[model samples]
Target: MQLLLLVDNNDRAFLSDINLYKNEQGKFIPRNQCIKLKDTQGREISLLSHIDNSDLYGAIFTKFTVVSSSRFINETVILRGTNKHGQDVFLGLLLDKYEFRSFLDKEDELCLFISDLDEICIFLNNNNYLGSGLINERSDKQLFIDLKNNMVKLKPKMNHKEKFCTSFRFFNKDNIMVNSIIIPVELSNIGATNTTTVTLK
Candidate 1:
């Protein structure tokens, strides 16, 4: 996937290369990420000869915009941010439905805006991630997913052919039938406050 990212703070604007790859263990690894700036006339901003402080604290990642391909239409891209303070943050990506419709013809381009990175950090400060950042909520909630293990023998209730999928099954280990709509349960809710752990069997 190719993404054009523009990160801008009030005083500075920079462009960077964001590359994603799969490792030998079948895990996604991101690297070659750097930021550079240029003028309106397209002159490369020199990043050298500057005092460097590795401690990045209270640095707000504002006006974050990302544009990628149609292959990333419904898929979420995992993002990790290391602030000046050495704090790590996790961000989940959702394809902006409004922008998806507005830029259909240009499906190769996907855009997302992130206001405050800290809010996302607070939400995910405790959770672990599975492949592709598919998070499993640690509450008594289940989201429907098509799998071979939990299929039921009964006929499907829906009439629409497009709605019926081959891998239809119950949602959890207990074989609970998921409701029509899925509700997300977070750590702060229901007297539970812990990071959701993801373990691959």
Candidate 2:
């Protein structure tokens, strides 16, 4: 997992080969796990994390303290930020809605922009992703994904299957299911089309 940081000064920072530890008998234990990350500048802050790697959207991590340390406590590949949702650690990942998408690419981007079909354009909205540079602005958040377009940003990687399951169950842990939507975008010879419909009840 990679570690990404966002600074108050609008600088992005990153740390590869991120390590996590729990003070077991005054010894920091390293647990092998995978997560996503990026970086920014400001005072470096740290959190103790236990990343649960059982889903595709990303890991579910919780914070703990094993020692009385400064801001730097333990290291993990966790994405931290703030918005209307408040400060939280996000195991950031997009839903797998694109059939022609490769998981390897854009794995570094952790910012998520969830919308229904009403909006034809999805902007990266950097103001929303405070303190993190790992996730840059995206231009394509529309229902129609240009399959022939070589640029991956024009297409979305949102996973529709996880909408009711992983998304509802996981994000609800923090009561953060506010602005997120999980719709499936399927590609056809005619172009891109949404196979699922979302209705607010």
Candidate 3:
């Protein structure tokens, strides 16, 4: 496995100058790999790492040594790691709304979701980009995948106020009932935290 430190906005050069090693706290320590001390026989020895789940391919970036910035809060850093198959994956550690998980249907596919939508549209052109959904129930995972398929067509529902709020789903080709995400605009009064619990049927 190999690790790379990216410049966040765009893919940039690899940082190979900083020295790093595992510490007792499980975080990588820069410029300090080992410590010298006396062993049982009074002979000088090194006290090395004893932390579990230490990543060998991970790195430590000291502010003055790695970057000139005093803090990393404003900086966007992406850590890219490659597996044995030579496929690379990147993570924006400090970026908001950035998450990647294995696909619910296929192992080869990765599911990436960005979940911030105001209201459901009246009529969405088929194959258009739909917002993200968070499956609340355990059994809803497969239901979500089957409903959110590309072959399905979903339309909004007209509520008591004569407003199109909720969405009902149907198949595009076959009459088979395929599942999809539905949002009720009435109950969608989300708080300032910007969190919504989605239900899948």
For every model shown, what is its TM-score relative to the native structure?
A: 0.21, 0.19, 0.18
Clashing pairs in 1: 55-84, 56-84, 56-85, 126-195
What ordering of candidates by TM-score runs from best to worst?
A: 1, 2, 3
Q: What is the TM-score (0 to 1) of candidate 3?
A: 0.18
lDDT of 3 by residue, 1-201 (tens): 122221111211122222222344633333322211122242222112221111212232221100001111111122334322333323222111111111111221111121111110011122221221222232322433333332122221223332223344322212243443343322132489633323222
Candidate 3: regions farther than 4 A off:
1-18, 22-30, 33-78, 81-87, 96-201
Q: For candidate 2, lDDT tens digit of each residue in 87-193?
A: 33333322223210221123222312212211211111221111111223221121112211212222223443323311111122232322332323233222265
Worst 10 residues of 2 by lDDT: 64-73
Worst 10 residues of 3 by lDDT: 64-73
N/CA/C clash count, model 1 = 4
Model 1 TM-score relative to the real fold: 0.21
Query: Each candidate's root-mean-square deviation in Å?
Result: 16.8, 17.8, 19.3
Error of 3 at 66 (Å): 18
Task: Please name the candidate that would achieve the greatest lDDT relative to the true structure.
Answer: 1
